[model samples]
Target: MPDLPPIVDLRQSPTALRVQRGVMRFLRAAHGFSCFAEVSLANGRRADVLGIGPKGEIWIVEIKSSLTDYQVDRKWPEYKEFCDRFFFAKPPELDPDIFPPEEGLMVGDGHDAAILRMAPDGPLPPARRRAMLLKLARLGADRVHTLMDPGEPL
Candidate 1:
């Protein structure tokens, strides 16, 4: 397979961007999951990283670059509706104890990450799952389309 092109995400902070990259890398390499970043959800909230496993299990990872970001953002709970599992990924130096125990946790650098605390399974409703599957498919297709033909509007 050809190597993926480097795409810069202007919306993320340096620390947040690193956390997002490492989380995406870990999901793909360790769990055979296809991941996308800055995903728009049904609830009007954007997800930091959204992934679908080989078995079609959906996961949403919320990245926290600093303690302030985590504390200021109370919308993470809303993300649970769109995924089978949810996680908070951050730099290894950050204290994991600040995160809620019910959700998953990950710690690493920009290179790679590990799922230090596994999240509980919260299966989505059948209708919602079907909708999200469609959303993911369309998002993936749009990305490919844009990557292949930059002049075309997605």
Candidate 2:
């Protein structure tokens, strides 16, 4: 392989990883969304999980491994600007009551998961939605390209 930029991994704890996997599986299996992880939005905030549905609807999922993890990460609110709905996913051990009802809630483990609550519809403006779709498409394409051609710059 030729010289390529070193990519920074989005490392998560085993618990966090399990939560993420379950959320991803639930979204794809239940909602038919093509989910992507660590997607950086235009505002410079990276969403832990982002999904685009068949009708171009966007959703962002933030995984919290524990109560402390939830307290530490307050950036989830900013992610709302970029998606039609926002959700928080956590392991079954984490209590769902802690999450705000205004947003969605999901519970899962390593294998599979389910959405406990769905976020209210908050559709993006037409222009913003278009821009976001373009960004997601390009990002998805670039990621696939990197997997295909390892030597390419990310």
Candidate 3:
């Protein structure tokens, strides 16, 4: 058999992970979004950053570290069904104008971030809102439990 190429772990890369951290920090501090990183949705999609606001508003932010990252992703549209608002978060070096005008934009620098455009609200049905809320709560609790007891299974 032909030798296989070495596997690449994009999630562990410094740039991508740093962008996520900065986005998360900005969401939590500035936007009051108590978020869960890498949240799994009902449609078998994983959200990069899913946050729940005080008013139970669901907001999702998809991080794109570079132009290539943004261009390659086609799943972003699917996230809209699961949230009240959607946004794309990227490093300041990226051109925010490339993102869809209908969606929101945020720029990050591995420590802080700013929202360049606000996303329009598309309220979710009560049923979906309830389901998402429950899921977020469960995920958050699971993480806390895992932190408290490293050996525990989630």
- Candidate 3 Cα deviation (angstroms), residue 38: 0.4
Candidates ranked, most accurate by lDDT first: 1, 2, 3
Best lDDT goes to which candidate?
A: 1
For model 1, the stretches where C-alpha displacement exceeds 4 angstroms are 1-9
lDDT for each residue of candidate 1 in 1-154, tens digit (9 for 90 to 100): 4333223447788888888888888899999999998889889998889999998899999999888988999888999999999999989888998999878999868899999899999998889989998998988887777678766542
Question: Candidate 2's residue-wise lDDT over 85-135, tens digit each?
Answer: 999999999889889988899898888888899888899999999999999
The candidate, 2 or 3, that scores higher on lDDT is 2
Model 1: per-residue Cα lDDT at residue 59: 98
Q: What TM-score do all the candidates reach, one by one?
A: 0.91, 0.91, 0.89
Misplaced by over 4 Å in model 3 are: 1-12
Candidate 2, residue 9: the lDDT equals: 56
* Clash totals, every prediction: 0, 0, 0
List per-prediction Cα lDDT, in the order shown: 0.87, 0.86, 0.82
Q: Report the C-alpha lDDT of model 3 over 25-115, residue by residue, as the tens digit.
A: 9888987889777877888888888888888999998888889988999999999999999999888888888899989888887898888
